[model samples]
Target: METKNINIPAHGSNVLRADIPAEYKWHVQDIYADEAAWQAACAEFKALLPQLEALKGSITSAQGLYNALHLQDKMSQMLDKLYAYPRLQQDADNTDQHLQAIAGEAEALAAAFSSANSFIEPEMLGLGKEKVAAMLAELPELAEYKFYVENLLRITDHILSADKEAIFAQSRLATGTAASAFRSLVSADMEFPPITDGEGKPAIVSEGNYMLNMTSPDRELRKNSFRGLMGTYHKYRNTLATTLTGSARTAYFYASVHNYKDTLESCLAEDNIPTSLYDGLIQTVHDNFAPLHEYIQLKKDVLGYDEFHPYDLYMPLSKAADSFACTFPEACAKVEEALAPLGEDYIATLHKGLTEGWIDIYENKGKRSGAYSWGVYGVHPFVLLNYQQRYSSISTLAHEMGHALHSYYSSMNQTYVNSEYTIFCAEVASTTNENLLLEYTLQRANDEQKIYLLNQFLEAVRTTVYRQVQFAEFEKFIHGEITAGRSLQAEKLENYWLESNRQYYGPALTVDQELASEWSRIPHFYTPFYVYKYATGYSAATAFSSAILSGAPDAVEKYLGFLKAGGSDYSLNILKNAGVDLNTPQPVTVTLQKFA
Candidate 1:
């Protein structure tokens, strides 16, 4: 109970959106000139709904299918614009009621539109694959939809009868109850006990600020925050285990109902990713635990700690040094230099977005907490960030900008149907930019900054690559248990979590009991089998980063091809064209060596 004064920043009194400078805020107007314009567009779109219904029965003919597909594409493009504007507006100031209503209207209309067009996929599949291909061959205008149509046909086995599909869709509401309970328990109902911060004032630990405290230089603060945070979760262990078990059961049910062999197969089949890709990543990371152990040992040595624990993992090795912070303009300049290898056109587009209010740069009251790059078709991408001027924040700026530029390229080059990239490729673009920033900064860093940068890079690998795989393994274990007809009771979950952590953390470190309770708090468990993509994506980025840095022939062009390639190809194949093969262990091996 140390009670020394802590100089925590003040909460409350959030700055109004109107009070923020125009340049520092996101340009929501780019989506629509005003609310009145948005209303008119919504009306026009609503009136055009009958046109889609008109083509419902006539899609049997090639020309008719082409017309329907073309019309759907046009409607989607406008619908995206209509939805993106208010959604972004609501995010900017979540406390505003007007924006909330606008967002609701936009979402409801989009959902209705989706329901209205749900017949297209089933009808198109009913026409059979050969007929669809022949129609595609006959209609040049629908050629852009070849891959889309092919994918729908490829998954024809999984698409149930209309009545069965309707039942499954309705059951989704019930299937998701476990996830909803988990979310409610963690976010709304969970309470973290107050912990002492640096200088010893009482501070409350929360999800919003937990990472900040975890990364604090104050040892007691970090230790107490970890304890305080997990203590709350520990109390809910049994309840959470049940909820997680239910979620896993739900995944199994869906897999069984859909005729997939297992939960992992079902999830991968969505992106047309093979099970080998997932298994290869787990096997590779398991084989290469030495780099991770060595990095952990380095942290212990550098931090001068007698024993390393989970709480000690996030503190910077160069804790006594001043934190690196930059102004928004300065961050942009650093990112520009880092992204220099991506070609002038890429840089030019990024520069325009940076200056032209495409980014919401600062954190005021009620602004979004984390960061993301999002936009609909026909408009430039918008990034939401809480820029606090840290050196890592510069990397984050670069990461989101990478996503933004990827969207820019995809939207500019590909049709609306193919403009949105998959999450597998999306993470690659962002992490590639992060790697480039690390390399660029290292080139000019002094000894201290170099050590700091290396430490940061190692941290990135630890969290993104190693930690995510550990999570993936845990996910696999629980889902495997369910598929094998075993129950995921609290004790079973704790044991499995501890075993997974020990395997990754190695014999050099202690696997604390508190850490086993971590599975109770992870949200990804509800989504089952989604964490491995982070590991795979980061490995792919490392490979691409190395290629571009080594000046390999056509490397830049291949990498740019990756950015412009949206949903046109399967995720793994898209990376294959860019020269990184996830099916092999080389990317993971190369990334591990880089960590060394």
Candidate 2:
């Protein structure tokens, strides 16, 4: 996707100046040229049922099974287009009726495909992986799909009863609806308190306005907004809890019905991510508590606060009056130039992304808040950012673009069946780009940019590594308690959160009384222990970034290979493919040493 020809105007101080750039409006035509064509494809997918059924019995032998799997891969790959069109379309201008309908059509298509998929897993398990692999080895078509087949086979031990699995699959209408509704609620309905300026003057606050306020150079106003927003959100904690609990219950229910021991086991079982990776993050954080505490001390000292509080964390430690503020186009150029070490091919894709219409790069009316990179498979990634004119906001451009470029490269290279990389490897790509951008900017810096880049790196280390590890540890504890059949009461959750704050911060900083409610606000806890990678990814990315910058022999080649790998390898193997060993303690220790 490219935004080259789109007419987007960056107008106003706090308002969206540009309409949705044309090319940035995903190439839905890549899936089907028009609504009528989408309907035609829908009919085609449904018409294949007789064929999908015929392959069921025929897949009993190796050749028959290999042929069937190849065909199934085609059907599934095409269905992605049929499903992805709506979600991406709706996400662009979430309120558009046509886009919403498009999303609905895609989801309905997915449901139909799931009905077909409900049989594939069980039938494959029924055939037994060993027999299927032996037969697949002899067939050329199936050989390329071994990783996918092996991925499926590895989870056969946890396969639910065929009847139970089918019921769960069909129940997507109700079960998925619950989560979807809450997502809409949070995205489209939730509101916050009015923001105040540095002198405690009142200002209007809305979903899209809070980001500009949070990055305000006025420490006091940022604090006021942070406190006020947290206070307002705390009021809806119970409601948000319902949203999260409903999602968790669905996870728990499926895990239980699917014959898995618990939610964590079931989640990691399919993804092939080990529970130890999660545990490794927590243990590493616990062992390195002192650096985090020292980093907190560094903030308190630099900010000249009598005692540091959590609200003070996001504020910058140093700022210069004569700073260069980047407009959207300039930021894009900086990012593209900074990441040039990734090779010409990578830079060219980013160039197309900027020029062609892959980015919706401004704040606008009724736009969904926050930044993200998303699109259906086969199309280039689109980025949504409310690009305010601030230095840190420029880093955000680099960050979201990292995700977009990662998606772009992976989709271009891999088939839809295996194109999308897991969240486990996701943060590294984005964070690695941030690292590169910082290195390049800092290397070319005057005193001000150097200070800004150093402080930015500090913030990155603190937020991604320390803060997320803290969340990861908290999530693990919460899940362990829940899995052990204990209730996750709000009071218990707060106490553990505050106690955690004490341990991680040491005896230095005073914990805010109200901030004890932080646990109630973190939605990651509800995702069943998912935030650890934010820390581990940063640590790993730091090592990788250092290598590429150090100009070590073959360093750039290895790092680029990692980026191009897509979902061709598992998370650990992907890192090893790029030349880092997660199993050894090296990456963790290296990150800690950098902090020291």
Candidate 3:
């Protein structure tokens, strides 16, 4: 595949999927060839569920265990491919009813697969560790699953009875109701009134364009966009509150049933992360507030605002880099040049992904708003990007490709069972790329551009580290409230969010009332305790990128090893061996000091 010359459509064009060239769109066919093939695979997968059920109670023997495990891997790989096709299509253009129906069907199939396969773990746990170890030793081929078995046995205390496990697995179908409702409400139901654009024309306020509006130089537009966005959520406050409360309660229910102390423990336990690390992240950020405050104060000074408001936060301080923009091809070239420090092989693979139909490179009518990188186990990774002709879009390209390359390396090296990495380490690869891109751009910048790029780096750390930790702190509070038998009422949640913002941003900034409703709009809150990883990942990336750029011995080699390790080992241990340790506060503190 060769790189194609494609330009992003002008803003507000309402470009259709057919308007974009084929190369600019990802090849979902690469997963299944067509919908007919996907349907056939789904049927084949359904037929194999009974076969998996047949091995449920037969894992006592070495051969029985191997057969069950191997079959499970095979089925899982099939399901991954099966699910990826429709989800990718739906994300590309969600307006199509057929795509929506298939996506829903794929989700249902996944839930069914989960319920059917729930018995494997409990049954394996029933055999006892020593017996399972004996079976593993008896079968040389089982060596591949030794780590998995050991990890399972390590959490044996949490594994419930077979019946209870089945109930829990079936609960998967209902567990996502809160999150699903939240997505529907925000994406489809909620409507923000149009705000004036920087040019004094009416611009629609959407989740996609909200950030773009925030970055606009027009002060009224920024304030109105902020007000319009958050005020709409405020109008639906009660409904949004109920949805979030349901999500929290759901998490608490699972935590309590699993014998964990709290939702935080239950969430971190999967990756073997300690609750102390999560707590320490908040405390460490609290301890190091001067740099953040100083930055905020500088922003206020630069913007010449008597009262600094939430809407003013994203405004570019440097006029020079504020107008920076790049087309999709230019963004790709910039990212490739920025990532060249990872060596020729890494860049070559990245170029292949950029050129080949591995990316849906531009936003279209009804496409997903944000960006992500996801892939089937055996096939190459795919990236969904709403590419704009701006520096932020370039950085986003680098960030997501970092995820893509991480997935690519892991899938190439690990089995399907371990190809998926934990959320704890997911941000490391992506942020490292962002950090490298910033560094590359800064190095090549003139004096005026340097000021802008430096501010960009500062804002990245502030957002990725400080802002995320603030969100983490809020998560801990809300979950603790639920754990303590309290409710997450709308007003109560809003009040807490206000106070938290004040404490984090300090007196340098005025806490707007609209900002209090900000918590209601964050979709990540549906996934309890997940946001802190962005902060931790940024810290770890800072460490890795510093070392790699400073010519540390084998730094690139070590970082690549971390990517390839995937979920094959514990997340913390993987990072430890790769040189950053989240077990201590050094990484966070060191990252903050750089900001200072």
Best by TM-score: 3
Arrange candidates by TM-score, descending. Answer: 3, 2, 1
**Over 4 Å off, model 1:** 1-22, 34-40, 89-107, 166-193, 232-253, 320-323, 364-368, 481-495, 520-527
- Cα lDDT tens digits, model 3, 443-465, are 88888888888988888988999
What is the alpha-carbon lDDT of model 1 when measured against the actual structure? 0.81
User: For candidate 1, lDDT tens digit of each residue in 86-186?
Assistant: 87876676667787678768766776576556557767778888888889999788888888888888899887664465456546655777976775566
Candidate 2 contains a number of clashing pairs equal to 11
Candidate 1 worst ten-residue window by lDDT: 1-10
Per-residue lDDT of 376 in model 3: 69
- Scored by lDDT, the top model is 3
Clashing pairs in 1: none
Report RMSD (Å) for each prediction in the order shown.
5.0, 3.2, 1.7
Worst 10 residues of 2 by lDDT: 10-19
